[model samples]
Target chain A: MTEKIVVAYDGSENAHDAVNFALSIAKAAGADLIVAHVLEWSPYSFLTKTEVEERHKRRKEELERADKAIVSPLLQEIQSSGVNVEVMVKYGHIAETLLAIVKDTGASQLILGRTGQSSLTSRLFGSVAGSLAQVAPVPVTIVP
Target chain B: MYNKIKAPVLGALASCALAAPAAASNIDEAVNEVFANSTGWFVNFIFSPFPGTTFPWIVAWLVVAATIFTVYFGLIQLRGFKHSIELVRGDYSDPNDAGEVSHFQALATALSGTVGLGNIAGVAVAVGIGGPGATFWMILAGLMGMASKFTECTLGVKYRNEYADGTVSGGPMYYITKGFAERGLPGGKPLAILFAIFCILGSFGGGNMFQANQAHAQLTNVFGDFPGWITGVVFATIVFLVIVGGLKSIASVTEKVVPFMGVLYVGTALIIIAMNADKIGWAFGQIFDGAFTGLGVAGGLAGALIQGFKRAAFSNEAGVGSAAIAHSAVRTSEPVTEGYVSLLEPFIDTVVICTMTALVIIITGQLVIDPATGLYVLNESGSIQTVGGNSGVALTSAAFSSAFGWFRYVLVVAVLLFAFSTMISWSYYGLKAWTFLFGENKVSDLSFKLIFCLFVWIGAAASLGPVIDFSDASIFAMAVVNIIGLYFLMPIVKRELTSYNARRKTGEIKKFK
Candidate 1:
C-alpha cells in the first residue's frame, strides 16, 4: 500500500534537507509527496481583498522563486528516482493550512524543517510544525 | 431592624478579627509538632536520601551566585531593559538568524515554564503567613530577579548551538562547559560536569515532580473520587506522548496554553477585584502595614521580610537558570532582546498574578490564626488540611472561596490548568538537563521520561512534606549553579551587549519584520 507524505518547505537550507529526507522516505515507501508552502499574513492588520490578493500574487511569485531555487530541484531529483510528487501552495495560517492539507490529501506522515522564516510573534506563539504535531491527525517527523 | 442588622454584621466582623491570633497560634503549634515528628524522617529519608536535599541547597547557592553575577554585570537588568524591548521589537531582530524559535516565542515558552503554580499558590502561602507586607518584598525581589534573568538568558543565547540541521540546543550545561573551555580554564569540564549533575537532579525534583504533584492534586480535587492514581496515570501518559515528540511539541503546547491560561486566570482575578472595589483600598493598606509594621504575627518585621522575599524568589524564579534552557532555543542574533522579554515574566507572575492572590487573601481578612489557641475558627474543623502535605493549593482555595461565592470552582479549574501546563513545560526542562548529563540519545531520553513519570504518581499519592520541601530546595539549587556560570561568563554578556548596542546605533542592523 502506498503512503502519502506532506513536506513543509521554505527556501532555507534546512528546508532543503527536510525535502530530501521526505523524498527519500517517499521513495522507500513508494508514497505520494505533497510539497506545501504556507503564505502568511498578519492577523492583527486589516487589508482589503484586492490588497490581500495583490499580496498573495507577490507571495505566489516568491513561492515560485523558491520552487525554482529549492523545491523544483528536489522534485527533479525525486522524479529522476521515479518517486511521485505533487506540490501545494496555500495562503493562510501555517499550522491550520498544513493540517487542512494533510486532511485533504490524506497524508499519513508529515516532514518539516525544525525551524523556518515565520515572524517572531508566530514563532513565540509556536511554529506550524509544533502546532501541527500537537493536533495533527498523523505522525510528524521534524527533520533537523 | 437596623439594630438587628448592625448587631449581626458587627458580630461577623468581630469574629473575623478574633480568628486571626488564634489561627496563628495553631499554625505555630502545628509547625512545631510536624517538625518534631518529621525530624527523623527528614534526616533518614530526605536529607541523605538517594538524590538528597543537597540539591535545594544548591538552588539557594545559585541565588547567591546570581546575586554576585548581577553585581558583576553592573546591574545589567536595569540598563538593558529598554534595549531588551528594542531587540524584541526587531530593532535588532535578525530574520536570517540561525535558531529554532523567535526571540519572543523563546521568552514566552520559557515564561510558560516558570509562571505556573508558583504564582498562584506560592503567593497565597506568603501572604497567609508573612502577612500583607510580603507583597512589597515580592515586588522588590521580582525587580532584582529581572537582572538575574537577563544575565542568564543573555548567556543562554550567546552560547547557544545552531545545529548543522538548524535545530538549536542551548542552556546552562552548554554555556558552563563551552564558556569555560573558551576561557582555557583547567577544570571547565569538571565544573560543567558538576553543574550538569545538579541540573539533572534539580530538573527531576523541581521541574518534574513538583509540577506533577500539584497537577495531580488539583485534578483529583476537582473531578471528585477519581482516585489519584488515575489522574497520575493520565497525566504521565500525556506527558510521555508529548515529551516523546521532543522540544517542538513542548514549545507548541506551551505557546498556546501559556497565553490562554494566563489571560483566563488574570482576567478572572481582575473581575473579582473590581467587584470588591470597596475593599481594594483596605487591601492595599494592609499590604503596606503588614510589610512595614510586621503586625498581627510574632517574630516582627524580619519574619515578614523573609516570607515576602522567599515567596517572590520562589514565584518568578528569575535567577534560576532552568528557564534559560527553554529561552536558549529562540532564534535571534541579539541575546539581550530575550533578556528584556524575560523581565516581563516576573512582573506578570509575581507583581500582577501574585498581587491578585495576596489581595484576595488579605481583603477577605483570612490571614489570622489565634496566637493563644492556634486554630482556624471560620471552618468547623479549625484546621486546614493539604493534600500531598503541601499547603499551597489549600491556602489559595480558601482565599478564592472567601472572595466569591461559588467561584471556588473557578479556582479549581485555574489551579488544574496552571499545574498541568507547568508539568509539561518542566518535563522539557528536565529532559534537556537529562540529555546534558546522560548524552542526547533515545535510550537516555526514554529512561529519564520513565523515571519522571513514575515520580508524578509518587508525587500525587505520597506525602508532600519531603517531596515538596525537597523540590523547592532543588529549584533554588539550580539558581546556585547557574549563577556561578553567569558570574564567570558576565564579561562575555557585557561584550555581547556592547556589540549589539553599537550595531543598533550605527544602523548596521535593520529592524526585522
Candidate 2:
C-alpha cells in the first residue's frame, strides 16, 4: 500500500515550515501528502438568529478565502515537487479535527509545526501539538 | 422576618434617585398616555372575549390550536421527546455537514428569545392574577404547545427560501406563502402578509416593550421608584447601539453573557427551592388546588385557565410562529429533525424554567394567604395581593430576596441580562418581518430598528398595564394568523414526519454516536 503523510496547516509561517518538512518525508517514502486546515469552532457558542442565518454564508466565504489566499499559492509552489498533494478544510477544534483527519485518511504518519508561543486558551487547555503527540495512532513529528 | 432582613440589606445599596424630577415625570406621563391611548384599540380587539364569557378569544384560539396540533401530531412532544434530546445533543449530526446552524445553536437562540421577562415577570403576572392554580394550566399548555412549535417549525424549514449567497429566510411568511402555493391553494400571500404585520407588532410589544417594562420594574424594586423614562432612555441607547449601530462586539458579548446568566438564574432558583425543601409538597398542593378550585381567584377555573394559557403562549411562543423564524435557520436535510428540536423549546421555556419561577414564588410564600379562610388574599382589584405591592419581575425578585436579601441583587443582574438579550433577539425577528413586508434593504432595516429602539424607551416610560396588554394582544395576533396557515399546511409536516421516522427505522439517517 502507498504511504500517506498528514500535515496540519494553518497558513502561518510555522505551518509553512511544517508543510515543507512533511513534503520531504513524503518524497522519501514515495507517499501522497495530505494538507488539512481546521478552523477553531465550538458548537456551544450562543448566537443570535441573524448570526445563525448568516453563518453558512460566512463559513463558505472563510473556506474559499483559506483555499484561494493560503493553500493555492503553496500548492502551486509544491506542484513541481512531483508529489501527489490534497487539501481539506473544516470547522472544528484544530487538534481534534486534525486527529480525525489523520485517522480517516489512514495516514502512516502525522506532522505539524510547533508555535513558539501558546494561546491563553491553549495554556488553559492544552496546545494542539502536545495533544496530537500524545493521542495520534501513527508516528507523530513536531517541527520547530 | 424576610421583609425586615431585606429592607436593611437593600437600604445600604439604595439610590437617592427614588424621587423623579417634575420634568421627567411630565415626559413619562405624556409618553405613557400617548402609547396607551394609541394601542388601546389594537389591544382590545386582539384580547376581545367570546360572547357571554370572560375568556379572551385569542387565548382560546392559541389553546385550541395547540390542542389540535397535539392531537394531529400524535403527541409528538412525548413520543419524540427522547429523540429531541438526542438531536440537540448532536447524536444525529454529521460533523462535516454544511448546515447553516446546529440544532443546539438554533435551540439556544430561540430559547434566549422566549426565555426572558416572560419567565421572570410574566409568570408573576399570571400567578398574581390567577393564583397558584395558574401554574398547573401553564405547564399543561406548555406541553401541548410543544406540538404547535413542532408543526410550524417543520413547515418553516421545508418551505424556507435559500438564497445563492448562502443566506436563508424562513418563518410563517415563507411557509404560509410557499406551502399554500405548493398545495394549489389561493390567498396564501394575503395570510402570510397578515402574519407578517402581526409579527412586527408582536416584536414591538412582547419582544421589545414588555421586556423593557419588566426590566425597569425590577430596577425600581431595587433602586426605589423612579420615572420609567429614565430607565427607558438608558435601555434605548444601549439597544440602539447594538441593533442599529451594528456593534457586533456588544451583541457577541451579550450572547456570551446571557447564557451564563440563564444558568445562574436557574441555579439560584434550584438553590431557593432546595432551601425550602419542606414547602415543595405544599407548593405543588397550592398549584393543584388553585388549578381546580381557583382558591377564590376571580373567574375561578376559567380565569386560571385563560391566564395560564395566555402566559404560556406569551412565554414559550409555541404557535405564535416567531420561533419558527429562529428555528428555520437550522441546518438539516430532514426538516422534521428541526421540528423535533423545536418541540424541546416550549418544554424548556415553559415546563422547566417557568415552573421553577412559579415554584420559587409559591415556596417562598410571596403570595399573601388568608389564614382564616385558607384562600389567597384578594385586594379591591380582584387580583391576589402579593407581598411588597410587588408585581411582574418585582414580585419574582421579592420571592428570591425573601429567601436571602442579597438574592434581589443577583436577580437584578439576571433580569437585565435576560431583558437585554431578549431585546437583541427580537430586534432581528422584527427586522426579518419588516424586511419581508417592505423588501429587504438598508432603508427598511434602519427604519424598523429605529422604531424598535423607540419602543424600548416607550416600554420603560409606559405603565405595565397597557404595555403588557398590548404585548399579549400583539403576540396572540401573530398566533391567530399563523395557526390558520398551520391548519392548511399541517399535512405536509405529517408526511415529512412519516418519511423521517421510516428512514430512521431503516437506518437511512445515520447516527454519528
Candidate whose DockQ is highest? 2
lDDT of 2 by residue, B163-199 (tens): 9998898999999999999999999999999999999
- Residue A56 displacement (Å), model 2: 1.0
Q: Give the per-residue lDDT of model 2 (tens digit) for A1-144.
A: 789999988888998999999999999999999999888887777887778999988888888898999889889989999999999988887888888898898998999999666588678888889888999899999998
Candidate 1's displacement at residue B197, Å, is 2.2
lDDT of each: 0.65, 0.88
Q: Give stretches of model 2 more than 4 Å off.
A: A119-123, B1-21, B98-100
Model no. 2, DockQ: 0.60
lDDT for residue B133 in candidate 2, whole number 0-100 = 96
Docking class of 2: medium
Candidate topping TM-score: 2
